[model samples]
Target: MAQVYLSLGSNIDRERHIRAGLDALAREFGNLSVSRVFESEAVGFDGDNFYNLVVGLHTDLPVGQLAARLREIEDANGRVRGGAKFSARTLDIDVLTYDDLVGEFDGVKLPRGEIVKNAFVLQPLAELAPQHRHPLTGKTFAKMWDDYDKDRQKLWPVHFPWP
Candidate 1:
């Protein structure tokens, strides 16, 4: 089995979608290593704030299959596709890293570029897997978070209960 990290977020019906997403992930992947949920303003487009968090799991499924499964989970949770690149979402889950593999696999980029670009993705990731290195940058998530510009974006930890 390979260790995988995923970033999950939602702006529409944030709490319900976030919890539903976690439920689906846990049901499919067993126990998960979860990070504190954070609330952040939408990036790239004007929209409502989002609830975001990171989750770690181990799976034997290949990258392509795993990505497809995640999409199904999102679809079941009301995710809409073919919208603008940046828009409101009911559930958005991204594959961040797949056992240190880099580049695109099955059309999904490992160690997602958003890790370095968005505080919402990096903050929870650093909290969950501080020691894990970025597959391409070789920098630990903790260090990346420390180096990140706090003012570039604003996000704060929120009271989120997940089972």
Candidate 2:
């Protein structure tokens, strides 16, 4: 089984969508290593705050298939496609990394670029897999987070209940 990390977020009906997303993921993947949910201001567009978290799972599915399954979960939870890239979302689940695989594989980039650019993605990811190195940078997620400018993007942990 390959280890995979995914980032999940929701703004519209935030709590409900995030919970639903997690439920779907756990059901499909059997078990999940979840991070504490963080509430952060929406980036790139004016919108409500988003609940973001990272989840680690083991799966034998290929990269493309795993991405497709995630998309199905989002769509089931009311995610709309063809919208502005950074607009509000009902649910957004992205493949952050597939094992230590690097570069574009099966059309999805591994060690997602957002891992370095967004506090919402990096903070929770670091909390979940602190020692997992970035496939390309070879830096631990915890180290990346420690060096991150927290002031650049505001985020805080929130109470979240899950199975």
Candidate 3:
């Protein structure tokens, strides 16, 4: 099985969608390493705040197939596609890393760029897998988060109790 990390976020009906997303992930992946959910202002567009977190799991599926399955889960939870790139979302899920694989496999980029660019992604990811090094940068997630400018984006941990 390959170790995979995923980023999940939602703005519309935030709590409900996030809970549903986690439920689907657990059902499909058997077990999940979840991070504490953070609420942050929407980046790139004007909208409601989003609840974001990272999840780690073991999967036997290939990269393309895993991405497809995630998309299905989002759709099942009312994810609207073909909208503006950063519009409000019912549920958003993206593959963050597939093991230590680098480059675009099956059109999904490993070590997703957002990991370093956004506090919502990096903070939770670091909390989940602090020692895991970036496939390209070779820097630990904790280190990256430490060096990131916390002021660039605002995010805070919320009271999220999950299974």
Cα-based TM-score, every candidate: 0.98, 0.98, 0.99
lDDT of 3 by residue, 1-163 (tens): 9999999999999999999999999999999999999999999999999999999999999999999999999999998899789899999999999999988899988879998899999999999999999998999999999999999999999999997
lDDT of 1 by residue, 55-125 (tens): 99999999999999999999998899999999999999999999999888999977789999999999999
Least accurate 10 contiguous residues by lDDT in model 2: 102-111
Candidate 2 pairs with clashing backbones: none
| Model 1 CA deviation exceeding 4 Å by range | none
Identify the runs in model 2 with alpha carbons over 4 angstroms from their true place.
none
The parts of candidate 3 lying over 4 Å away from their true place are: none
lDDT of each: 0.95, 0.95, 0.95
lDDT of 2 by residue, 43-72 (tens): 999999999999999999999999999999
Instruction: Tell me the RMSD of model 1 versus the true structure.
Output: 0.6
Clashes of each: 1, 0, 0
The candidate 1 region of ten consecutive residues with least summed lDDT is: 102-111
